[model samples]
Target chain A: MSNSTAFSRARFAALIACFAATSPALAQPSTVGFDQISAGDTAWMLSSTALVLLMTIPGLALFYAGMVRKKNVLGTALQSFAITALITVLWVVVGYSLAFTPGSAFIGSLDRFLLEGMVYLKSSSQLSVSHIAPTIPESVFVMFQLTFAIITPALITGAFAERMRFGSMMVFMALWSLLVYVPVAHWVWEPGGWLAAMGALDFAGGTVVHINAGAAGLVCAWMLGPRSNFGKDAFLPYNLALTLTGASLLWVGWFGFNAGSAVAADGRAGMAMLVTQVAAATAALVWMAVEWLTRSRVTLLGACSGAVAGLVAITPASGFVNVVGALSIGLAAGLFCFWGATGLKRLLRADDSLDVFGIHGIGGLVGAILTGVFADKAIGGVDSHLGVQALGAFATLIYSGVVSFLILLLIRSTMGLRVTPDQERGGVDLALHSEQII
Target chain B: MVHDDKFPIAAQLFIRLKRSPGRVIDVTWMLENELYALEVLKVARGADAESAELAARYETLLRNRKPGATAAPQQPTAFARTSSFMAEPEPVPAEVGRHYVGSLR
Candidate 1:
């Protein structure tokens, strides 16, 4: 061979070696099939994990904390904080297995118990990819889905705030997550699952997260009864400024909630991002306009709630609808959720503190039904299918509602659900947690 | 010990002691809580050497240690208290009046 050809060959080999050294997987020919996975997609999902987790911690915590009365501020915030820790542990142990692993149609198996087979420590290591989220590693998918699981139960805490026994509340959440959330998640998101086979399209958990949690919240509100004063007193929010800050974070983080569901950094993700902003803006304005008409003044609280309502409504349709479809859904969510919070609230006679049922329940229903109506095949959906959407929403509502009530009933009979009236009157911060805002 | 005429208030306390000695001790503690210790001692001094003898002895020592004006009577009606500026005030909570302080150095 010529000396010039030898020199060229050596340079080519050096370039190839440098590229391989960039990532841990690239350093060795591992057993896990790491070749087919998209680096951009994996990176985006990892970032999405952080963003979704952010929604629960400071975002939901502050949003709830600011709305509660002064004495219960710390108590309320700590519930979200506690759930984040608790749910993460549960997800690590078995939640990931039961929700994402291949098993029966309604629920998954414990095949990945304690997250086995997720890491590749040897040269022959092959990464586990969820058939549903095939482009990303199973661990990344697990972390992403775990964030959803954490926030769903955390959302339920808003219903029974300032009144439930701390021990009982903890127990209730653990049971409810395993029994209600896991099955619904498996049915809807898993490919071989019943709802997914039934052609139900829940892009980012409109039915599972919002409707399921919302229905459970309604049951809890009824079972736990109302805050002591209920209808007789005016319970004002403690701090709207804190609420505003939290709402802003939730708004930003929700792009991860919806757009991240695309599981890719592609055109679909781009459209999801654009539609999310549109719906939020539209719903915020419509809510303000209607609120101004009914009440004398528009409020910051009104705008924030409207924005959230829009976000919830757009969730199921984020990947399926166009700009026009998104606007229509947002407008409907604002109008419906406002009434759900006020008129339907009075009608139900349920306290539903923080309006979880009103916003998430009503918003989820509106979005799910509308996902059926607005999902144009030209955009990115299967043929428009309202019947399928309604079926999915109805099933989630019934299952979560009944199971949550039964769980609460069992807990109520055993450990008791509420604190003593004296403890409540003094404030749950000091009563339940021995903590006071001051 | 049953001289109701010489010491009417003390005689009343003795009568209460007759019904329940435990209750009388509890009443003394209540009086100690609601009235000045020295003031309670002064009133107890004239009482008969009856069942509240232990209470009376404790009051007498408290009286000698900090002699002051007699305490107001415990009654159904609201009692007005003197506002003493000389006593130390409690330290305010950090969260309280925080906005007023504005940017600590």
Candidate 2:
């Protein structure tokens, strides 16, 4: 038997080999075979994929549905569901290849086009695994990342909720997913990504998901313009109960989102789960307190939004931060997101209908920057620079914003981005989808 | 409060009425009397040439409303008659202004 010191040296050598194997090439099929894949990690990843997917379908769907007027509830909810279907198909086709496979630092190669090289040959007992996650089957890793892809663009639908044409929305999201979402996912998550090379520490997509979606959401809000009589109308939500339920679902599903980023069922993943809970709970309480202090009453919406804000803010830091870091991040997320949704919303005057930019955008920024400040190297096994984090966050924001604007502009000039005023007056459910709550 | 089915029109009228410089308009009444509400909305939205005068006339009638008054003889209310600012016959009658105020509790 080997001595303890020799065992340690061997483990270090194995770690180096694993790191070397992950170095970006064409994601070079797989030297890691089926037997090598960890069953535990694969099981967790499969469950996490399902959990993350849940965050989009009924979770985001109901969250958005409850916020819209009675006439628009169906249309609003449909956006999330539709994006889920759309991105699922798109991710399988070319999106996965262009995002994950290594090529240029700016974008990925198409070696895995149509998931071509990904194989599961039971006869030979050989299966493919992604270089990024050699411990799990590539199929599970692909599915896990696909959930992230689905939710990112779906998040933007909240900004232009009551106004967009369904066909135009579908078109815009498809294009935005390809043009804006794909490259940014490559830039941040893919090992060959420019941001990754710059030592940006995004444990779970602070820049890639939240900032990217937030910027696109802001642009959508601006381009779609405000809902009719936006500033002057009450715009009461259809049902707070549904919103609360959806928020609860989101809160539960976020464990998969943050913890699953660890790609392993280890101590790190456990720490991520703990911090996520701490941050979300802290932020929820802080938001209600602020609302109670300022408005003399706490609102369910404020609490839910605060919880989501905390979740968003802590996402990038979840794999990197400790409990104290989570508390600070949660506190800042609550206070800043409240102001973002109210004061900054009024100041921006973009009519981001559902406060997407206010909460997700501002929350993402706070989280991304704070990750640099609070990242514990002991936990993450990496140190992060504040300037590098800001660079990654801002770069994603600008890239997503500009590309989204161009895509909207193109769609607008061709098919028109909004329904006519008459159609809008009739409610999108009846006018757009020919369905209503009755 | 407006019914869900009629909320779209009610919301439009509410916004238009709120923006127009005047006393608070009874959105519930306007929703109940939708056709006349559209006319009021057109004036409130400044779509009419004499919107200012029309709005003032409407506000005066709304202000003088007497709740719980049964329908009376077809007597012209103060706002129904024309003044220097008006040419067309206004729709305001005493009964039109007398909308019910339901219990809040």
Candidate 3:
């Protein structure tokens, strides 16, 4: 290894050591004498888990597949499905521990690696650990949240689709999940997390998931550069029908994603679901109306995209905002995201292939800001933690952007980010798998 | 919310109205302008007026010859044109535009 490589490795090792040292010294809590769980909560969680999984497998996969050039459709879908499998396994092995174990403000140590002490069925409350859905078992909760973790990085892949090598992407994702996503998740969601301590109220990962993914996606697209025919060619989706269906699935699945964050069959979950639906509906209408006025054609693709943008915008604030707040947020997200995807992106000339930064980044930013404005104490039942929410959002945006850029640089230096021109022309499926449609 | 199938129709209508070959039309203006026009039309006629009134108003606007008034309907600008012969079955080059992908087959 070079001197810099050796130094980086040494520094990483030392940081891991420091993390280990600072972990709480408490022994694993015994799982004896816990009361039986409610069937309604159990059913809700199970269905929510399925919905979240659907968001990745068919929902996100198809959405991205339809957006890419026809030659790369199967490749894009395969990557999304593979991420679902990979993240599930990783969550079971160490991802859960890194994100949820009782530790410092930044990240959790490996005390629960491979799910050591979580084999026994017990609620998070009974374990008397950090507060994160005390009603659900830690393992169940990890599995549910793993679906979110899986999709967030997969979403970024859309930004660099048709150009990235499969091997390089896999390596980047593995490292990114470990170094970036887990730490951010811990910071926002874990009971003793620094952001949580500072009173940041992220009901469903506005900062940790959407903003983090969006900023990182922007960096990845910048580092990877535009595709071969980016500016010169008129690149368009091959299948608007597929895109619409995927967007519909995402709209439905998001209710589970946002509401299930509450971890109980409660009124808050109902309100979150309601707001999610209203926002999606409003956003779809707004986007269609805008497109009809501007382009004189209300394409299905625009409406689907608008619905998703609204869904993303409402994720963080779904649990906090009332119906009126949801409507305003949704309408704003639809209009602003449409502008970002078309006007701003065209101005910047960055090939964020499928508008990841526009829809998710801009949408997430809008949600974070609106959360500050509409966080009613009577609705969400939490004090207006607007300042802390702003701080968390700003911190996540800066950290994820800089670190994601550095990681992309490191990966690019080690193993090139893009495929050869011939490989890209031939298609990633053929290039990576040595198979074509025939 | 309208489904995706309605998008093309809505967009076509929007483009038709925007570039209606009328005087000084720029389709690239924001949606707010379209809403403003709709509001103005609604106020000019009654809100309960049918589609005939709207069509009459559109025709009048298109044919008006006052100084600085909108011009008569003319051939579409290059940008307003779609690839020709898209609904046709053949792969003929001239039938479609020069850049049309049908020629590739």
lDDT tens digits, residue span B20-90, model 2: 44323445445445344545655564743444445555445444556763322352332342122133222
Q: What is the C-alpha lDDT of each candidate?
A: 0.78, 0.81, 0.73
All candidates' TM-scores?
Answer: 0.76, 0.78, 0.75
For candidate 3, write residues A76-142 as lDDT tens digits: 8888888877777888899988888768868887877887876453354343222465555555677
In model 2, residue pairs whose N, Cα or C atoms come closer than 3 Å (at least 3 residues apart or on different chains), thus clashing, are none
**Predicted structure with the largest lDDT when compared to the true one:** 2
Q: What DockQ results for candidate 3?
A: 0.01
Instruction: Report model 2's chain A TM-score.
Output: 0.94
- As for TM-score, the candidate ahead, 2 or 3, is 2
Q: For model 2, how does the per-residue alpha-carbon lDDT over A41-136 read when each residue is reduced to its tens digit? A: 988889889999999989999988998767799999999999999999999999999998887777788888999989898888888888789898
Clashes (N, CA, C under 3 Å) per candidate: 7, 0, 8
TM for chain B in all models?
0.26, 0.32, 0.23
The C-alpha local distance difference test score for the whole of candidate 1 amounts to 0.78
* lDDT of candidate 3 over B56-102, digit per residue (tens): 45435434534674322252332222123222233334532332221
Reference-based TM-score, model 2: 0.78
Please give the RMSD to the true structure for each candidate, in Å. Answer: 16.5, 12.5, 17.8
TM-score of chain B, candidate 2?
0.32
lDDT tens digits by residue: candidate 1, A1-438: 496576446545543543333221211111247775788999999988899889989999998888877768888898899998888899999998888766666777786789876774446556767766777787788899999999999999888877888889889999999999998997888764577756788888899899998999999999999887665444556788988888888899999999999998888988888999999989999989998898757878889999999999999999999999999999999999998887888789888888899999999999999999988787674765676789889999999999998999999999999999878776788667654543
